[model samples]
Target: MIKKVLSFAVIGVSTVTLAIGLSPNTASAALGDQPEVFHSSYNPGKSTVTISTSNTEKKPVKASGYLSKYFKGYAHKAKNGKWQFHLDGYGDAEGLYNNVRNDQTVRVYLSEGKEQGAFDVKVKTIVKKNKVKKKKAIKISKAINGKNVKIKNNKRKSDVITIKKVSKNDKITIYNAKGKRLVQKTAKGNTIKIYVRQLGKKAGAVNVSTQKKGYKESGKIKVKYGRE
Candidate 1:
């Protein structure tokens, strides 16, 4: 049986660091830090959005203007480079981005101080999760520690283990406690199921992770399970 040692949700950040311009110099050059969009989270109750960013040097960065359609604000920074917006479609926050719904695509551009050029666009789908109050101990496994390729929740009401969906065609590999391969396959629908009988009896614990192209492979996350 696989037992969960803790109860929590996986909070993660996705980063995009590409810049575009009409001319050569502007495309690659900037006086400012040219911050990278770290992650974004939404609040349904308050209708607020917080965009977090960090610069190349991690010193600090500033936004001179809002050139995008969904958000608008001036000199937007308090500390640690967090810009705030409300989704009312008036004043600071524009509502047409109301189209940026769960599983819906949202496009954001990063421009630098005082010079606005045609931006190379990168479209990202921001998926939001709603919190559910539970009284019993959670059933799923979490990241063994703060590491990449988290074991996302797919076992809430299941007896077996599951990995959260990954991008199509990516590989999902599972291993035994002592480091032996039990199952390996490509994600056709972007998700995989963990079966106890397939892994056999000696898999006291298992490690789960997916293959990220071009990035180093990670399979260090531990999922504690035992034989009956």
Candidate 2:
């Protein structure tokens, strides 16, 4: 059987980050006194909608803007070829944008697909917030006291040994050379124990892995049978 010992540290963080820009001031706006005609705003950052020309069918329009400072990261994408919107700081599925919108303006250019006359324009902006959580400072350790295993065959019975460490809430896994798991156990206390069949002649090397809530550690142990 294979056994392992390890230690680890746990750390975590909490925060919020939103990618959708749905706010009140960032709402969509129109350049004219039209109702059904308008533009779209970017994601969670500064929501702004600008409309130019109240053509019943505005041939589709696009708008782009930056995200808030509190946001960890932000990204946006549109439907099909409807409207081609490009924000400075916003990134596309292909890659990051060429420019960044850090105090930059929400530059939105529009053009008609069919109509060719004067068009009314409208613009609006909205703002929102988000939260996020993360884990940090996770560590793992595995140290074998000896390079050999001890075995005692009283009547060819199984040898129950307890492998422990100074870590709590740790996960332990044991595997053989062929990647076959013999016994997998979790650490409730700082240490854990296991029982392996003591074959007087079946003694060799095995891999052991231990992991905590946020940290991961691994080590190896040599099992020796027929020891007084």
The local lDDT score (0 to 100) that residue 32 gets in candidate 2 is 26
Alpha-carbon runs more than 4 Å astray in model 1: 1-160, 194-203
Which one is best on TM-score? 2
What is the TM-score of candidate 2?
A: 0.35
Supply candidate 2's per-residue lDDT for 160: 52
| Residue pairs with backbone overlap in model 1 | 89-95
Q: Candidate 1 lDDT, tens digit per residue, 1-228?
A: 222233344458444344332454553453344445322333111112322222221332222234343242222234885332221223233333322222223334324333232332222222234478788753332222323333322233323666664655656667767777867766666555555444443325677766655444554677765443
For candidate 1, the TM-score is 0.27
Error of 2 at 129 (Å): 16
1-228, model 2: which lDDT tens digit per residue?
Answer: 222233444457444333454443333332222333233343212334333222112232344232221111222333762322333322221233322233334433222222222222224322223346677666656544443223344346665545645366666666565667777777777556656565234444445666657555656555434442
CA-only RMSD, every prediction:
33.0, 28.8
Query: In model 1, where is the ten-residue run with the lowest total lDDT?
Result: 43-52
Model 1 lDDT at residue 166: 61
